[model samples]
Target: MTRSCVVSVGLLLLAVSTLTYGQGLLVVTDPDQVVRLPRPILIWPPDRPVVRPEPPAAYKIKQLEVNARLLDQVAQVQVSQSFTNTGSRQLEVAFLFPLPYDGAIDSMTLLVDGKEYPARLLKSDEARKLYEQIVRKNQDPALLEWMGTGLFKTSVFPVPAGETRTVSLRYSQLCRQHDGLTDFLFPLSTAKYTSHAVDEVSFRVTIESAQEIKNVYSPSHSVEIKRPDDNHATVTYKTKNEVPTEDFRLFYDVGKGKVGTRVLSYRPDEDDEGYFLLLAGPKIESKDNEHQKKTVMFVVDRSGSMTGEKIEQARGALKFVLNNLREGNLFNIVAYDSEVESFRPELQKFNEETRKAALGFVEGIYAGGSTNINAALRTALAQLQDSKRPSYVLFLTDGLPTVGETKEMQIVDNAKEANDVRARIFAFGVGYDVNSRLLDKLAREGFGQSQYVRPNEDIEDSVSRLYRRIESPVMTDVTIEFAFDEKHEELGKPVSRVYPKGSFDLFAGEQLVVVGRYKKAGPVKVTVRGSVAGEEQKLDFPAKLARHSEDETAGFIEKLWAVRRIGEILDELDLKGKNEELIEELVKLSTRHGILTPYTSFLADEDTSIRDTASNLRRADRRLSALAEPSGAGGF
Candidate 1:
């Protein structure tokens, strides 16, 4: 049968949300509270899978910057773009952009060459989600997936063929969470949740046009906004003026280290790693043994999903990791399909000859049959049990638990229980096909780490990054213990992490910031402790926690806060059902905070959504890990 389909609006919202990245609660009682600008958007999936013979991306990566505070459940991104005009003759330009479900669209304007043109959101999501969601009228799942393809929001501007016209955009947004990376999206604001916080959100903008014509200039818009020209603009928003708490002294949240930037290739950035992991999440540290011997179980999935170059890459990566194994380290291999096969019935003794022989077996391995992940896990556990050495299971796969009695949740519980046995599990996800959440849980329970490798990208870089973390434990088992000095600032829930900020996908430099108010000051210090292998280490760092730091770190702090708010909004959308007003507010906040929210692209009137794009992407990605269909394949 032909696959299920839907239009996408949330995707377009990615572009539109940036408009209000610097404004606040200026509730518009009237329609023209601000000019209704034309909607702008990209027609391609930004994270589409990379096939062999890599071709140029259809929608060029004009500019992409995304900073997320996973604990905060909020994400902010800036996308700069340019489009080519292939018209035969001078033709008018128009655009149709979709808003995200939990976001809003504002600061809509069009610029040709350098001249500014008025734009408007003339469409709505009236019909799109009627098919994808239950409450069609009240909610717009289109906002979650919509990317306006046929719709044009720009004032019809004439341009010549074989020419390139430059169009520039500046906007902001706030969004909620969604379920399943596939078409299945869960809103976090399902029960009863609400938040009102905004922070400094900005990114430098530039554009190139193929069809050149018309003058350019930046027209004044909202907030502390300024536009130097159509191709460039800057906006900044104030963070929460009054923090919520009054118990302890609250400070802006930054990755648990000095706020700074650096150029590096071998390490993971505190920012890139996400605040949740370094903060409330489990601490990571690898073991080393100059004397004590340990066993490692390499769990490989030779299912059909691992077919093609992807499998080859996995095999190569696996081999590369295997090569690093030191002498006296016992190891075993579990290759699973519909059933299970072992590298040897039991853990193999580590030595030069055996290692080489195992590598040979890995090279000869081929992909076929269905998936049996649980059985593989069980067998690997058995090998570790049968051997009397500290064991580490490197579980790798690209699909869901398709062929086993062990349910996904059960697998998670069992993995956690297995950890108590002193065996650690390090999980690696390949592309969008693997169950990331499950992998995340497995790693946490096993006291290990989870790393994801996207296709066509540099797998070596990803693998190397994980290796660095394993080797170094700047701080481990880190639990932030800070007493409020005076409860001056209601320091919102903070995400603590210590590492280089560059790791954050957010290209702009990372500065730690707090989202609360200040009342008093006192000595502040954070204590972190964890195991580096089987041994324990501890550190206490003197910190300058503050109610407010108007400088750079505040931006980083608030971005982190916004992520939390977005999570709540997504909860509302996915669980409680649609509440446009709440979503709109979130969209407005995300817009101001430089975060991506669904409200920006989701339209309540049109069924238009980017689901098609992501869905098509899902189908195209035969390697995707998602199983329950409607959304084929998985994610990238």
Candidate 2:
């Protein structure tokens, strides 16, 4: 028997995009929206799997179910979907899933004809090449983006003329926090991209926290919430036969204090080293602890390039910050281009009269001259010499240094020296042309973080969102230490790097998640230390290390650790030009677990396959290790 097959590359894209990070089953969408597996037209005998030639009039999504659990800030999600075959022919197909940014797919299962099949993970380059070949042969622009992103692949055979096949995927990621809230997003807009209306879509999320849960809200979808107690809540959403144009998004805040400490760990094998994630923060203090007063300074860059909407947005953001300053808090604004100007001669207390005057001052600023980033930072830092108060400098810039201290590194170093008062420098890069390395280095040196906004995003929104998190400082100069005994010393340092990568101030209603490695696993105690209102405070949390490799609760720890670690590598690459060692490490980590970083994507070029590159690297690494070892006869 002979048979011919032609699969729809569009349908394959629907499958891939559905795996985006979040807690729920992603419905498949149109081909143009996401990169997808190549459609292969095959001619073979009847026994082999074959694609159908005719396109279905309507490709309807039958069902979607999402189950998610949060252990502190880490989310573990399971997604299950039923994609029906409406056409009247026995067809063979493979459903593909693209990994969400900074997320790792742990496992996948496919069910067909009452049997289950496991899925496979492919290297980015290998996957990209496969899709590219299909795109070239079939002229499918839809598969282009799939080139570098890691993916999960599963196959189903013999659809039997009107049957449905199910795919289930389990994955996890570290939820990002802004201000006091953690945001969770699920890609659920695929139904709108499909040919037909989705029959049903549903989502359920179970939140568990040691602290009291507050303000569980969804901005993207209307949801019903059920709270059995302060520490637990369940949220659900469902709809029938409708188009979904937006992804599902939810935000929730957990109260601070004793309830804020949590431990999440993962180990794939007992023989292998394990990884751990720790989150700790202080609760809202009473009058006795007294929240510390904060001093905030905004350094705005109104260079010639920001003459249009960019400068207006920056001014709007400054106004928003002034209006929201806490009472008794000290604040100031500095607008600079070729020359620097200040709202007041010095920082002033936040009050109605000053805020009103500040708003007026912001409106008078206009974009002109060249960018003087060095002097701008110096002027802002000059007023923040008070060590007793927690100070923050929100530096906003849209272009590179053009007027004074034109060198990027010199400006970063100067900024570091001027920040002697320990003001956290949260940098905002408004456009693509700004030097990202300078911003990143500045933030790292000043004990803060850097954020980037594209041309389409609103700078005001980004600035306002960041202000909320730092609005109410409860703890400052936070440090974490793990209790190690004589028995634990043999295992070496258990922690390699904590996410955020340095000491930070902890605000009220906020939690910190730290990732690290351990040489050995056993019972352990962790301590969090910080200063509140210029007084030292300490808290301890009890956590027992997972003894074996199959600790279900900690399965996602390793992936989250890799995400942060890869981020560090990227930072280094940005700061100190690219290197072979860094690129090799990035490619290896990405291929092993599908972490999609810009470096990994760049390394996955058309000239060579990522998997082959990784394999060659491993062989070379082994050879180097062997050469470095000392011979018994020659060793002293």
The CA lDDT at 453 in model 1 is 58
Where model 1 places Cα greater than 4 Å from the true spot, the runs are: 1-77, 84-295, 308-313, 327-330, 344-364, 378-392, 398-402, 405-426, 429-476, 484-521, 532-534, 551-553, 564-594, 597-636
| lDDT tens digits by residue: candidate 1, 465-542 | 443333333332333344433453365333332222111111012112222312233334444454344455555554
lDDT of 1: 0.40
Enumerate clash totals for all models, in the order shown.
138, 5
Compared with the true structure, what per-residue lDDT tens digits does model 2 show for residues 19-127? 2111122333332333322111111222333344344322346777788887556678888777775656544444455443356555455555555444323333544
Q: Identify the leading candidate in terms of lDDT.
A: 2
Q: Give residue 508's lDDT in candidate 2 (0 to 100).
A: 57
